[model samples]
Target: MTKHNNLQSISVRIAVKTPAVSRALEEIVSTLDGFEQQLDEKATQTDVLVLEVGDNPAKEFETVRALLEDGVVNQVFLTSAKTTTDILLPALRTGAKQFFQQPLVFQEVQQAFVDIHKERIAGEGIAVEKVSIKPGKMVSVLGAKGGVGTTTVAVNLAVSLNRLYPEKTIALVDMNRVLGEVTVFLDLQTEFNWDELVKNISRLDPAYLAKALIQSAPGLYVMPAPNSIESGSQVSSQVMKQVLETTKNSFDFVIVDAGTQVGASAFRIFSSSDTIALITTLSLPCIINVKRLLGTMRLLGSIPMNNINIIANRFEKKSAISLEDTEKMTGHSVYSTLPNDYQKTLEAINTGKPLVDVAKNSQLVKSLNKLAESLIVKEEPVVKRKSWFW
Candidate 1:
C-alpha cells in the first residue's frame, strides 16, 4: 500500500444487485467526504467492498468469500433483507466484515468507512523491520461463584499493574459472555467491543486490536464484552482464543475477567493464562465451589496447580472459615488476601474508578499492588528466557 500525500478520497466498490441496497450505498457515499465510489469490476483497485445479498444469498456469500480468499478485497460490507440466522451466519462465515440490514443506517456505514480509512493510513506506514514481540503474561480471573468480587480484583489488578510498570502496555479483557460489567466498573464509554473484533477475527492484527481497545487509563487498554446477551453468545471459544493470543502478543500484561460461568471459551482462556486467579471468600459455598473448580482444573490438566492462584477476597480476621481451613479444603494455598473494606470497595464501584485510584491507602489497594508485583516478578523469568535461550 502506497501513501498519497494529497490523497483526497478513499475508493469504494459496490457489488449489490438489490436496488434498495445500491441506493443506500449511493446516499451514504454522497454524504461522506474522502470516499469515491467505483465500479464492481474495479474490486482489485478499491479499498472497500459493499456486496448486497441477491436472489441467491449463498452465491453472494461465496463471492464475498472468494474476494477475501484471493486477497482481492480486505474489507467487505454485506447487506441483506433476510437477516435470519440462516443467512447472516453463512454470510459472516464467508469473511464479510460488516452487515447492514435493508435501509442501511448512514451512521453505521459512515463508521465502517472511517475504520477502513484509518486502517489504510496505518498500513501505508508499515516498516519492514523485524521487531521482536515477547508474548505477554495472561492472567485469567475466575470467580468461584457470582457476587464474589471477581471483576473488582481483575480491574484493580490491571490498574495496579499499569501503575507499577508505567512503560509497559497493559490490557484488561472482560470475557464474561452474558453479563460482563468491566466497562461499567471502569466507567468507559466504548463504541466498539469484542463482538466487532470477533466478526473480523481473520483480519486481526496489532493495528486492528489497537483500534478495538478502549483506553481506560494512560497505559491500560480494555476490551470490553458485548453489551447484549445475543451478541455475547456469538463469542465462540475459537474467537476467545484468537483474541487472547493476539492480545498476549501486543501487551505486557493481559488481565481477563472470566466471570463465574465456565464454558468452552472460559476453558480456552484458562489454558492460555500464565496465572489463573481463582477468587473466593470465606463463605462455605464459595469454598466448596472453589474446591470443585480446582478438581475440574486438575482433571483437565491444562492449568497446573502452581499457576492457579487462590485469592481470598473480602477477608475478615474473625471469619468462621479460617485461612488454614480454606487452604485445606481448596487444596491450594491462598496467594493473597484482600481485606474486607466494604465501604471503600462500594465507593470505588459506585464511582466507576479503580480501587487504587479511589482508595489509595485502602488495604485492598495494597493487596492488589502485591498481586501486581508478583505478576511482574513472574514475567522477569520469561523475559530472561527470551533474551538468553531464544
Candidate 2:
C-alpha cells in the first residue's frame, strides 16, 4: 500500500456499488483535485466501475463480463472479502484491470487512479508524444521440432551480427514461452526475464526496456524467457506483440528464438517478424514436420513464402537425403545448410561460447557468419563482402 503522487490536471469518473466501498473511494478521490465520483448504480458513462463481490463471486463476475461486453464500462476494478486466486483469476479474465481486498488499501486504490488517469490522458492525446523510432528488422528463428539446433543458430547469428556491425544495436529474445535456454546457451545470468516486463506491459517504454535487457556481449542484449513453466502461460499474444513492437523500435536488429511450440503467441511473433527462419534436419520425421509447419504458415498467410528461409541443420556432404531432395519434399527451397560438425558444436555449447568466439576458422562458424551476412540490410552495409555460402 504505497501512496502515489496526486495527478492534478487529469479527472476520473468512478462509480461504486457498495456504500462502504463508496465511502472509501470518496475519501481517496478527495485527495486528488480533479477526480469525480458518481454513486448511481445505473450510471452508464463512467470511466471505472468498482464492483464488490459477496458470497457468490462467480455470479458477480458474470455481471462484470456483461458490462464489459455491452460496452457499458471502460474499466473494471473488483473488491471482495475472498481474494484467492480462484476469485481473482476469473475477475481478470473477465476484464477486471485491478483488484482490491476488503477494507480497501487506499494506496493501491490511488495507484489505480493514477494509472487510469494516464491512460485517459494518453487516449485524449494530451500526454507526451511517443518518440519516433526508426525500427529495425525482426528475425524469428523457429525449429520444426525439438533438438534441431534452434538455439545454436539463434545465438550464433546474434553474435555474428554484433561482431559484423559494431555500431548497430542488436537484441536476441528467447520467446520459447516454456523452458527457454537462450540464457543457458550464452551463459548469461540475468536478474529479470520477459515475464516481469509483460506483467507491467502498459508501462513499456524505451527506458524501461533498456533496464530489463541483459547485455551478453558488447552490442548484443538478451531477453531470456522465464525459467518456470507456469510463468510462460502468464504471457499472452497481446503482451508478445507489445514486447516485440517495443524491441523493434529500440534496436537495430532483433532476433527471436521461437521454440518448437507454435502457439498463439508464437504465431503473433511470426506474423510481425521481417524474416522467419525455419530450421530443420534431413531426416524423414523432421522433413515431414517441416512440411506440416510450412502448410500451417501458408494457412496463416502473414509470413510470405519468400520471407520464410528454410535452413538445414547438421547437414552432411554425403547424407541419405540431399538438399535437392529436401527442397522437393518440403516444397520450399533450402536457404542454407549448416555443416554437421558434432564435436566442435558440442564443445562450443558445453563451454557456453559462441561458434565465432571459440572456433572462428571452423566450417560451421563460417556458414553461420554467411547466414548472418544474408540477414543484414543492403542499404545499411557494415562492409562490402561477397556471398560465398549461397
| TM-score of every model versus the real structure | 0.68, 0.66
* Tens digits of lDDT, candidate 2, 1-390: 222244434333444567887788878877864456765556555667777777788888898888888877777877777756577546655667766767777766776776677666666566454535567789999999999999999999999998988777888999887789888888887657788678768757654565467788777899989879999787789888999998887788899999897888888898888898899999999999999989998998887878889999999979899999998998999999999988888888898899887889999999998998896666754332211000
Residue 236's lDDT within candidate 1 is 76
lDDT of each: 0.80, 0.79
Compared with the true structure, the alpha-carbon lDDT of candidate 1 equals: 0.80
lDDT of 1 by residue, 105-210 (tens): 6666776776676666657673433457778888999999999999999999999988987767788999888778999999987656788788888778665576
lDDT of 2 at 218: 75
**In model 2, what are the clashing residue pairs, if there are any?**
none
Q: How close is each model in CA RMSD to the real structure?
A: 10.1, 11.9
Ten contiguous residues minimizing lDDT sum, candidate 2: 381-390
